[model samples]
Target chain A: MKRGIAGSLESNDALITVKESDKLEITIKSVVYDFFHKQIEKTIRDTLSELGIDKISVVCEDKGALDFTVRARLITAVKRMEASK
Target chain B: MRRSLLFIPGNNPAMLRNSDVFESDAVIYDLEDAVSVTEKDAARELVSGFLNCAGALPMEVIVRINGLDTEYFSADLEAVVSDKIDSVMLPKASAAYLAELDFLLTEQEKKKGLKKRINVVPIVELASSVLQIDEIVKCPRVNGVLLGAEDLSGDIEVMRTKKGNEILYPRMKLAYACAAYKIDAIDTPFTDVNDGAGLEEDCRFVANLGFNAKAAIHPNQVPVINSIFVPAQKSIEWALRVQEAARQASLKGLGVFSLDGKMVDKPVILRAENIIKKARKYNLI
Candidate 1:
């Protein structure tokens, strides 16, 4: 696992800027490759669907998480996003 | 009306006594593949006693007897014929095997003084069984035909994949044959309990294919199976709307009516009515 900020997210009054802004930072504890990027995107999309949320920026902090762990973490991030909203 | 037919080992006293609580539409007390040779007699005794005591259980009870090749098959039939179980499952069956069992069961039903005919649910496990499904389904007293994935895979010499059923074509053929007979078609269980999403996907797939029920190997899978078979709320609501429109049209001397820009005929109306009937059973409406 590598310790570094791997992903970011930010939200505000405007949709595009909020999605584009990178205030929320994540330090992934491991080194993962582009092979996981598509799955991570799908996990984020599906988790958002289950949470009944849309139009939100998701930044994933990956510590070499497998599919199950990725889904769980994405769900946890969505819950945190909701609480912070 | 079983949406989930759970397989419980006949030798397990705890399973035999408490399986009904899982709310499965049917419970199959298994005496065949699940039981070893030494446990066959004990399993039969336990299952027979359980049937006599199963007065208040709401679900259908089925007994999976040993195959005819085994020595235990005769005794298994002898024990179950006198009992009031819903069906007797004939495992590893072909057309010839089903014919023999059909005759035996009919004679047993008469001799044992059971007013109702004992139903036979056959497991079409071998390639031979799949090839002869049409003739096999027409066998008298045959209730439902079920797929046995484990044995089928072994017979075909295919490696079991994560998708678990590479034998989908043969399985679907069996389902089609059952539908042609207007009898129930049951799918095999998903072996992995941790794969809840996979289970739901498979249930929806089987339901779409017109399988009447699925067999559950474990209790945890029961609730998911029940929910998948139960009509969705949106579907029920739509069916209700169609039913109401048709009823009003009938009062106005119209034999066919248009609902949501689609014409409703006898079959469409019947489908709506069935949805309401199933909803009423589930108390959804």
Candidate 2:
């Protein structure tokens, strides 16, 4: 019983991607994931849970994003993805 | 009217919104050289929305649009040029660009029913543009001309020396052009924001050269630039004493008088009047 769905963190030199879904819809946003990936990942995960969607994916387009920006953007993408779902 | 004009990247929404909080005479919403081509449309949309919602700030607001040669210039012009903003900053501008922008701005003003004229601030970023300073400054719609030191340095392939001795002639010519036409001349941004003392020295140098204002790349530089342009405390005191002497001389119907062993002529009186004006502006009077 996968209530919400899955979230994946994809890393790249210039960007990062996180995907989370309940198998209904998808949303994506890019952020500077520079060296702050850990904080950004946590923020995205927290936002997904808050949206009550267990399945989620977050994607980040990084140009060396700061920790706070990653978190802020991840939260935004999760909220947007969940609402569209 | 911008005592200090802050340059905010056209794409950054947070910075654009936060710019209003920085105490400056104006904030330049930059869309031209600061922004990459791919982000132009998005930046334009975001700034448009921000201008509509941002509360009336104490300073003037302007948008720096892409050059006429850029692919997004037309769209940038169409999206901006509303009555909400105070002026438009044209980068790498020529007299031709001035004509074109003024035409479009006039049309926009008519369509939007704006009461005030939308002024234009052109940047002399290229060698050719600098050479055409007289022609550019003479344009009616053009309010002022700014020296784009970074790009000019790159364009001419000269390394930017900190002292700025390399562009001395160009700066003098620009000052001359602005003075001849009675238009405001603005100095380029001082890249080193950490060097407050150096920045103040540069502001004084430019003010002495007759530049009306100087651009600031960071918020910390704003106060220094503004304070430097203002009359000095000692100078203010002298102006107050001179003004009082002149008032007393007027009571005696003496057009020329001496104050503290100094002969006060018309030019001296005028200088004192100018100082009084500056003092009044700062509430020092």
Candidate 3:
């Protein structure tokens, strides 16, 4: 799969996108970036590691989404990517 | 006594976060049709995480998991059959499915160590299930029955009318079955959010037909359903009068009583007693 996306730009939600890539990369843009950037990144990384998923570029566009929402979106994005190929 | 059960899309966090404050007696987090097939996993995680993390809210929490036939059913139960949820609303319901659900839910409760036994409310939509409603409602785990008119309409090959005549037989069947089993008889939701009058009329019609509660698709419909489903002031007053008359008749050693010059039998007295009980429960008196 080239690309897969999950969630929406709605409030309390984050749009997560996963792209097939040679190396792992993570980028996050959030409304509360300075306050939660590291925390959000840690959540994403912890979730990916826990799920045993690797070698994908992750992009999260956040609108004040909580930890659960972020994790759900990323998991959904990965499932979508896997469903394609 | 859930007068209004608001259906919140399980995938939507904004609504899930504010479920308690919606003025609904119960909130059902929908994991079935409200979610697309692709996001089923995401919704399961999101709902379980939110329910487990958010702690207990004021109102009852019910999760409408996918039917038992689907692959998502067991996963949904694994994620949500916890203390956070008060009940499970099963779509595509049957006695066999209820039996399976009862076993699975009990297993989940034992596995998760949930002290509370999760209730099961089967959505009576399949035509065969409608015919076998009495058997379904008799299940040990069933606490109520929710009428799914939309799917039943299609299953029976009839278009759902504004009057909802297509589902009348099933509605009465559910009402009777639930009454026989002494459980909640919840009506199907009114599809039109914009037509308040139509919704009100529908609620009143079903309430008169013995539906104790109605499902609300939107927040605007909550107040309307609560108003109609709750013991109305007029009925409460009449029930009070009936109780007073019954007390006097019993004191006089009479087996019968009269209210407003009409004979009040055992059934009428029983109905009045139930109304008074409901009013007291709601603190309406």
- Give candidate 1 misplaced runs (Cα > 4 Å): A1-85
CAPRI quality band, candidate 2: incorrect
Provide fnat values for all models in the order shown: 0.00, 0.00, 0.59
For model 2 chain B, the run of ten residues with the poorest summed lDDT: B37-46
**Residue B92 of model 3, lDDT score:** 92
| lDDT for position B254 in model 3 | 81
Model 2 error, position B127 (Å): 1.7
Ranking by DockQ: 3, 2, 1
Give the winner by DockQ: 2 or 3: 3
All candidates: DockQ: 0.01, 0.06, 0.59
Please write out the lDDT profile of model 1 over residues A1-85, one tens digit for every residue: 1121111121100001113222432222224436665665665567557766665555565545444344443443444344445
Cα lDDT of model 2 by residue, B157-272, tens digit: 99987688877877888999998887778889999989998898888888888786888888999989888777889999998899899899999999999888989978998888
DockQ of 1: 0.01
Chain A TM-score values for every predicted structure, listed in order: 0.54, 0.43, 0.94
Could you tell me the lDDT of residue B4 within candidate 1?
Answer: 89
lDDT of 2 by residue, A1-85 (tens): 1122221233321232445555523233445434454665565566556656665444555544333334434444443444456
